[model samples]
Target: MIMAWWQILLLTCLAFWMIIDQITVGILCNYPLLIGFVAGIIMNDVKTGLVVGATLQLMVLGVGTYGGASMPDFMTGAIVGTAYAVMTGKGGDFAIGLAVPVGLLMVQLDVLARFLNVFLLHRVDHFIKLNDTKQAARNVVYGVFPWGLSRAIPVFIMLIVGEKFIRQVLAVTPQWLTTGLKVSGGILPIVGIAILLRYLPTKRFITFLIVGFIAAAYLKIPMLGVALLGFAMAIFYYQKTIKSSEDHESNSTVNNANGKEYENDKGEYEN
Candidate 1:
């Protein structure tokens, strides 16, 4: 399949995303956009791809890195979701909405993949213990190849078989249910934000986040503008807080020394 011109290009990009997603561990791989855009190019439907990509982007806007853990298996969602969405003759909000649940379902499968990868590591370690370098290399290759195949095969199968099932499921699902999923899709980023909040030590940063939300909600400020303002505010707030702390420390030290010196002078005078 990779030999065909368009399929080759798509697979190359897919492979690139897979490699990068593993290396950066998903932090750097924006798979949704890549999948939608590349699939769009292959299918000659760039606008639909962009719309789907942008919509999915917003749906995941609140996702973040937490304690070295990624939000979910975005690559699976990207590849499978894009393929399914495009194949279903849907675009824009509908396609994006469809992709959201597909992405969510893939998370569990991703955990399974992680568990299997861990087992592979143990097997690799066993080879290393025997001083079998070639075996170790083979073990690593075998381990990594399955990980790639696990992702690629399921996605390929979904593209061929799962798309129709998804369409039927969506057809049967009530309007309200789909709408709820869309709403959840928009709000699910909060889970990521909450994960990020664990690292926040000061209330001031929380206040800024609230302010940004208010600006975007009430003031009708653009999201990008609000994000930029929030970033600037966070920087300034932390800098000022740090400076104030240093100044307070210096003042405390100076005052303590002055009190000790005054006590010594009084003792000298009394003596």
Candidate 2:
């Protein structure tokens, strides 16, 4: 299936915008859901785009590029995968299979972009030492190119070449492998959660975690309700901890004052 030239241009623009957005604006446009939605609009298949976007979003729910660490790039996946699915008349499962691997492969591209940014940083540093403020600012702005290209180049190539390549793969790939990819897509979200748990104060927050899980799993509470419950619990915990600390401080102050008074009386009596 031949994607229109305009469609290719639009997707590439989005890919570039999302990467720059992650770096500068941080308005979360780089997320899979938004990418998929826009991609769907471009591809004239909104429903399929939404489905692919949401699925990819879940797979990378807790994963982030924290501290410049590499994570799977669901944004790229959303664009390419959704396009592939819509073009090929494949469903969300097929899209997920295609997207997950694309996301994983893009991690290397992310690292390369970051490595290139180091040179820009050094240039900025040199300008700073020379006391050339304008050049320093210019160098900082120039840094956007490396990042934009890192995402945009691959997206362009994929949009042009991926449809045929994916069709070929699907044609030759065994049923078992296709099924496995779908299953792996479903399981991939757990990895994001596990990574998140590693950074969380699990023991400290375990009670809340369990409560949220139970509310959702057993009580059949909707996610919004569960989130509200969590919000209320957070406020209660904050107040309780603050009150406890204040009371302890007050008691310590009273005890110290009483001890000083007793010492003075004993000294006066001795004199």
Candidate 3:
């Protein structure tokens, strides 16, 4: 796969998932499904890719990163796991199972990335204090670009160099170790979720989490499908809420104006 230009390009793209994941804040742009889908496309296994993407997406659906804290590393797991699955003609579940520990390790990588960012943050602050706008911009580059490249470049090199070695390793590993890795992988994300829930609005939102799980686990709703449904519901709820608020504001303005006008009329008559 690495021999072909297109394959290399796609794989390079797969590595950039880290950069994109770093930059984007929303659920839409995050790692899991996007990486899986990309690998699937590269391998001509779109269904498996999409399925893997969606499954991993659901597993981490309730998880979020707040204030640069560690969360499961979905990018490594999604891209690498999907690539392995595609190359080996394995199922999406295998990709998901394998991705778990990789995802957890990724959290540490993210923490390292954040630590690197502290230097940049300090430089940016220094620039602000010095009132050196141009110097600040330069400092921002010094801080951000290297970190972004650091995230992408090594993974690209390693994925290319280590692809074959990984396959061999996977083949010889015992069932117990593989099972342990997968089980540990699956369980590790729960800690990420717990971390996320700590910063979430409240326990009330937990019900929505359960409902979403049932939808995926039993009803077999794809990750994309569930995400779209949730989006539509949120949009509907937002519009309704906003409209009601606007209506109340308008009504309050009218009432206040009428009261002012009536008071003015009484004063004029007395004058």
Top model number, lDDT: 2
Q: What are the per-residue Cα lDDT tens digits for candidate 3 across 1-271?
A: 3335566566665565456555655443665787677777876778877776766776676666787567776766777677666765546656677776667766666677678878888988998999989988887766655445544664565467545776688789888887765565456556656756777775855666777788888999998988887777679768989999999999999999999999999999999
Clashes of each: 0, 0, 0
RMSD to the hidden true structure, all candidates: 4.9, 3.4, 6.1
Q: Which stretches of candidate 2 lie over 4 Å from their true place?
A: 1-4, 37-69, 115-140, 162-165
Of the candidates numbered 1 and 3, which has the greater lDDT value?
3
For candidate 1, give the lDDT of residue 9: 45
Query: What's the best-to-worst order under lDDT?
Result: 2, 3, 1
* CA displacement after TM-score superposition, residue 121 of candidate 1 (Å): 3.8
Kindly indicate the candidate among 2 and 3 with the higher lDDT: 2
N/CA/C clash count, model 3: 0
Worst 10 residues of 3 by lDDT: 19-28
Q: What's the true lDDT of residue 123 in model 1? A: 81
> Which regions of candidate 1 fall more than 4 Å away from where they truly are?
1-20, 23-71, 85-89, 111-119, 161-184, 190-206
| Lowest summed lDDT window (length 10), candidate 1 | 1-10
RMSD of 1: 4.9
Q: List the residue pairs that clash in candidate 2.
A: none
